[model samples]
Target: MHCSVPYPADHPFPIENLPYGVFSTAQDPEPRPGVAIGDCILDLAALTRTPLFAESPVPAPVFAEVRRAGSRESVSNLDAFVALERSSWRAFRRFLHGILSREEPLGDDVLVPRTSPETQMHMPITIGDYTDFYASYEHAFNCGSLIRGADKAMQPNWRHLPVAYHGRASSVVVSGTDFHRPSGQILASPGDSQPIFSPCKRLDYELEMGFVSGCFCLSIGAQARLTWHHMQIYGGKATQLGQRLSPQQAQEHIFGVVLLNDWSARDIQTWEYVPLGPFLSKNFCTTISPWIVSMDALEPFGVGQYAHEPALLPYLEHDGGVNYDVDLTVEIKADDDEYHVVSRSSMKHMYYTLGQMLAHHSTTGCSMRPGDLLGTGTLSAPRPDGLGSLLEKSKLGREPFGLGSRKDMTFLRDGDSVRLTGSARGKGYTIGFGHCEGTLLPALPLLD
Candidate 1:
């Protein structure tokens, strides 16, 4: 189908990939739900006011909750809309495709120029909890080999389940938000016995993919049967506590995917990560792309998942091609330095699929909520150039990678900016997660 909106020739936000986001223009300063179409953003709030949206299958009540009473301003985030059932989500997508591709074009007021300086994108959803999962075999293996010998690389239980740590959701920021380098306790040398409190010298960015959870519902009966009507009526109340999700049931909980950068403080992590996994070293700041690519838009790019040895338990077992074949890249741009591509990888490198991760997450009967984020940790490819983080690319700072010829990087330096991007190729178009970017500011001054 052809799009009425005019976007660039190789635009990432084409008719086929109308990723959702929260944006505002100078004319309308309040943030509201929007979908990217070429260079313009279709304002859902405005569309609701028009006749075009009158016949849409998307429930009008959901859109009503977003705007303030008697005003066009959006007073809320996308938490409620994200909690809608899968059927509703599909119906809305189909409705959008029909109207956007029809011969009758939408008015200019219904669309905002996405490239305008007046336009700004914000965090689309109000995240409740964030979980970072070490689901990449290559990343885990590389880090393990660096610390331990190659023979003792992977932990025995690594292949058994999807290992994860609860991260600080409050610290999660949208793309383009710069942050100060975090300070923490670290050893001065490799053999140092005492630790010193200092600014992090080894700041790094982890190239990862994060899936946002939607549709909270309690599992009923021994088989965990879910009632679709409950979601439609109540609009997804929180999932009941002590409710477990099987692998087959986990797929429905995912709303969409976004590019995520789990910034790391390697030195701080080295000293404090012994007993507990990651603390302040990681919680400082996490960046994600503003636009979320829905599962419907990504279905065409499905690929076979990586083979897991020593077969997984029945609860965590899932069949079919759940993994996506999206190509990923990490780039670095420093002040007065040229932009350089640091590393290249793919989502296919993940050893565990997102469904497996979610199933394993709630295997112990943990409850889930809408806007819960689950990150697929550092999707590092097996090849050297395809490493996902500087920790792997630089070989634990023992080797420095060059960015152009004038500058070299062991880890991110102050004023250094990082950008992570991903794209799933289709017949004649591309599905992309708009850039997940962050610049490192100098650490705060030490107190006397």
Candidate 2:
């Protein structure tokens, strides 16, 4: 699995972890897709210049479509590429692995200068739809206990199905993008007669993992077959395609993983969310690591999906491991120049696996587009420090925690920065999503 690329022992990007992202250099401001390899970016646009891509067994119609339509030079947006079948994805990766090997058989001409101060990163995918799932056992339990009495913490249907809500895809941003604190109606005091419209009083971040959807071949007609890839590009309802996706079929549709920070305003959520799920409190911003580590790359670190206490139904059961043992960490940094690890947890603590989530989502035959994202909800562990959100850490602000600065607070303050990182260790490699980070800016003043 080794390649000639000079990856340091501790580097997040390795030959084995060729995560993809969209980037641009100062000289060429137009964004394009590139692959992370150690300190440098393997420019996909530049790769097309070489004979490798043309020589690979890329699906004909897909490649032909790209060539026929003079698109952007860089594979900058991976939406179209991700829609290809698994075989094509593997073929593309193999071609990359060989060229990146020590031999430099293709020569170093295609390499882009290393990512640095001059380079700019963009959102890797044009997310069509976003769904955030409350799939973690510890996170859901802790949040429930804090919000409701322990006696009635777990919702009756929580274990029976993967609880989720459709998220705002328009506001999803890449890492390092700062956003102003969201303003919303909040109850100034508990049991207040009326609510006040003001800035969020309890701004928080949810540490979670995100997965991107890819291509899936569907058995449509009795004698004919169609890949979900074609269905999406052509446009059709998945349910009309005639069959529900099995767990195994659902897993094949996963493209990759990214670190996700689902920003929340606790006060606003508490006031408004009763029957309906998250709305304004979450729509202001949702940040994600720019690079997406392909499912193929994460395969080596995969572990079996956790067993369901109340055995899952037949549709949710699958043949292989769906979870990866990725270590996730959240840190907060302030102007005082101090960095502190606020929480540490593993993705394996999730009660429902991504495959299960996908299967459940498609049970009704809902179509999943190439760039749709599914978020594994706040991945907290049973340990005290592993709590994922400030609501849990501060227990609804009754207690506050220190943030390296002299100030001990429950929620985020303006200028406070939050960063999340995730990685899974393999034989000699660390497969990781570089960082999902954001800084909170002062709330905007209201118009007169």
Candidate 3:
């Protein structure tokens, strides 16, 4: 897609990758939906107010609704856009693509554009709930071996279903927000008679990606199923009581993918996680990238899913399994004023695809709400350096990850900054999630 606006040839925000986000400027402090086109943000709200978008080949349902209601202002979040149907999603993108492309160009001067650096990004969606799934086979196997020993490595049910845990949505922060190290109860030894409350001794980051939704609500009791059939995926929760989502089309409901860093307190988690799963250890903080690269922009990067043993259930089985080929990386910038590439991996290492995770998530009919995040727990590969977390790279803090010959680290220090990035490569451009980053702050002083 050729565009009049100038952007770096290799920039992530190309005309073909119009990822959406919530942004504000010093002049306009109200957060509104915006699309990243090249290096500038195409103000969707402003565009909708003009007669140009009103001339789209297909009806623009999202803005049309707002226009009919006589509201010229933009909605504060993706709530309105998320409610849009598949056709509307396509129409909106097609309209923007058409206008931005040379085929049916519009004047760039009237769109109320903002250079990226001048604008501030906010939480794209008011996340209703969050769930982190252990979907990477290599990561799961490595961590399981380190924790449960080589003989008992993976759980019996791992191969059959996508395992997950409910995450704390309240702690889900947007990228650029640094957080203090969390403190929680810990056991001094494996068989300790008593527990101690203290700051985390082992702090780490999980390099993963998450998907948000625009579909209806899903609850555990009712259970939600991702009906993936005919190249369609619906986010609407299971409202028919026991009605299950089909497996024909499971990709439709997903808004897009974002880089996610699920910070972990290994000491606290190792002590508390058991039959009940992670609790206080996980509720403190989770970081996500600002922009959401919609599924539409990623369709070109899709390929057949990786092979796995053990047959999947009928609900989980589908033809032409789809998965994105995205390259991922993590880096650490410490107090020494240097950034070190700690690990580099790819999303293709994941044992189960995002669709499988969503399908398993709602298999019980759990209703998923718009902005609900589903994390692909710690993406890792078979190589030691390809591991996602310090736990695996350091072999549980026993070894140090190398940063040249002079520097090494087993776990993060107070001033350490970790950034996660990922992108789907295209012919001459890239579809990317800019950055999901967080700095480790000193934990608050402990009580006497």
**Local accuracy by lDDT, each model:** 0.84, 0.81, 0.77
Off by over 4 Å in 2: 55-75, 105-108, 221-243
Q: Name the regions of candidate 3 deviating beyond 4 angstroms.
A: 58-60, 65-75, 103-117, 189-191, 216-240, 404-406, 445-448
Query: Which regions of candidate 1 are displaced past 4 Å?
Result: 59-75, 218-236, 446-448
Distance from true position, residue 441, model 1, in Å? 0.1
Give, for candidate 3, the lowest lDDT window spanning 10 residues. 229-238
| Model 1, span 1-448: residue lDDT tens | 5988876656789989889998877887887888888888888878777777665556665445433311444334576678766766777787789889988888897888888999999999888789999989999999999999799999999998999999999999999999999998999888998999999999999999999988855457332333543233234455665777776678877889999999999999999887988998899999999999999899999888878899887878887737999999999987556678988999989888999998888877776767789999999998988999999988999997668663567998888899999999888888988999999999998779
For every candidate, C-alpha RMSD to the true structure in Å = 3.4, 3.0, 4.8
Better of 1 and 3 by lDDT: 1
Per-residue lDDT over 1-448 for candidate 2, one digit per residue giving the tens place of the 0 to 100 score = 6676676877889888899888888877888778898888887776765576677566684455333222474344776677666777777777678777746434455566666888789998778789999999888888888878787789999988899988999999999999999999999988896999999989999999999987665666322233644334422322333356777887887889999999999999988887798889888999999999998888877777777779877778877846888999999887586778999999888888788898888787666666789999999989999999888888889997677764577899898999999988877778878989999999999879
lDDT of 3 by residue, 313-416 (tens): 77787566677789999999875677778899987777777777776776775555556789989999788679999999999988775664435688888888
Clashes of each: 0, 3, 25
Clash pairs (backbone) in predicted model 2: 4-102, 32-76, 33-76
The C-alpha TM-scores of every prediction are 0.94, 0.92, 0.89
Best by TM-score: 1
